[model samples]
Target: MLFRHFYNRLPLQLLSIRKHFLTNKQNYTVIKNTQTYHNYNIIPDVFDEAPNEPLIIQFKNGIEVDYGNILQPKDVLEPPIIQWEHDAKKYYTLCMLDVDLPTRLEPILRSFQLWFVGNILGQNYMETGETYANYIGIGPPKNTGYHRYVIFVCEQKNKIDYSPLIKGDLMLPRYRNHFNYKEFSKQYNLGIPIAGNFFLAQYDETVPKVYKKLNNLSLFVTPLK
Candidate 1:
């Protein structure tokens, strides 16, 4: 009964035990809070698996076409010699879209068919495919912001007819704005693009007159916008 007598004579270490437990509890709460903050700031790598192929387009002037590069309408009035490494197994159709330069009068952005030549052996554009729509010179209104002109080279599933569009009278006002390049490609049996590029162009005084003349062509046909 000596141990029982010592227990009754001594105060138990309950306060010391409670203090140790509380310290550990606070440390654990701090660690959990820090871990949650760390997780919130972490960003996962999502685009690591994406394709890194480059689509290159250059002008005769030796200047490479890039997005946001300032250029004039006359500079590209004549089509640029477009180049892209093809998948030797299949021939592709070359489609170009001149995404319109927005004007104060018409703030809604639109795109027009600059060139929609299809069918070709290799890259011999002059030798093949129906030249459905001819290239139209850029004519953004004076003071309008730069226009984005995009060129898309798409894959052809089969030979497609562009006769209905080509044979019709080409008018600017009718076909100028709101041309859906992607839809047109789909309608013609052309699938996703093999390659693409774009450049920018701003407006000048002659733009209005040029657009008017384009609209007033004698062989004008009511465009299916």
Candidate 2:
């Protein structure tokens, strides 16, 4: 004679098993199914860890851009540096060091460059204008490594018409020969480059949108441990 044992609810038993597996953090392993596996102790948690201060960007030209002031959440305004100390104190917990480039910070720097370039062109709508979409390359080219971050405070020869295509907007093949670097130097009347540079900035993972909007400016906060 054959005998069998049955459970009242097999599905419910399996559901509870899955729930327990998910909820029990200590029982999980990287190689649970392996016959031989190694388990290591997890690192202890740390809170409010301070990152290396004064994040530095070393340009290919050997210049560095340092954010002159520490970054805070309040620095999101038109003149972010006005209440620097107070905001830093209040939001120190939220602040993190600005470190290497991340995908999130790319857009912020692009936006900043768009505005800076637009300001050169005497237009405020550069953000929404086709200028940003047309002119800017997404990131530096391969094998070029990291490009130098240079700030140009230039005065144009004529008030650039926002409607016409910008000089930088032309395709590399077509306009590469016509950039007129000499004319740019003559029109703008630039002096010898400054000796050193710095900018103070902060970043927070919680505020991703701020990074997206201001990525062009190269503002970012490094993630904490």
Candidate 3:
């Protein structure tokens, strides 16, 4: 029973490496924010270029996020306060994309929409904007390497048309993958992300509860591979 409990807590990478020594402090490490976005390929993967500035993200627990830092899924279960500077006259949109859904190296499910808010003005005016997709916190499966939760704050020239853009009920996981950086930019000319930042997360003991609470729906469109 104890072993099974411990197994659930161990991330996929640790288990794959055969690190059974839970007592060894050396096995635990933190990804420092000092690392550049290139280290994680955020430049080409999520954005054409580096972010104009770092995004200010904090959870209900008072832990603030910095670029490339690692966090636990349970710690960020709620929609975080996303802050950025922009001209009040211009509308903006914020998107959180989980590039590594099922795995880090080969994301068969390339991008999973974590959150999306459109038509926001300066000062994090989310209420005025459309809540395209209500936030769903990170819940990477128990055996995927660390997943990157990338936030891209794009400058919107105008309000988005919901018609052809949004499909099925976004509240459901299947439809939430409705938007992506490439599509939005091509269609609306939203322009490159003005500001962005991301933090990494991995499967943890809290993930099981998250799945149950959310109807056990994952990035899988249906019973996929």
Q: Which candidate achieves the best lDDT against the true structure?
A: 3
- What is the per-residue lDDT of model 3 for residues 91-168, given as tens digits with 9 covering 90 to 100? 888888888766777676667787777888675655687777777787787667788889878888777774664777
Q: Against the true structure, whose TM-score is highest? A: 3
Better of 1 and 3 by TM-score: 3
lDDT of 2 by residue, 132-160 (tens): 22222122222222222222222233333
User: Model 1 scores what on Cα lDDT?
Assistant: 0.56
All predictions: root-mean-square deviation over Cα? 19.6, 22.1, 14.8
The best-first sequence of candidates by TM-score reads 3, 1, 2
* TM-score versus the correct structure, for each prediction: 0.62, 0.26, 0.76
Stretches of model 1 off by over 4 angstroms after superposition? 1-55, 87-89, 101-109, 205-213, 216-225
Model 2 alpha-carbon drift over 4 Å, by segment: 1-67, 79-100, 103-114, 117-152, 162-198, 211-225
Pairs that collide in candidate 1 are: none
User: For candidate 3, what is the total of clashing residue pairs?
Assistant: 0
Worst 10 residues of 1 by lDDT: 42-51
Against the true structure, candidate 3 reaches a TM-score of 0.76
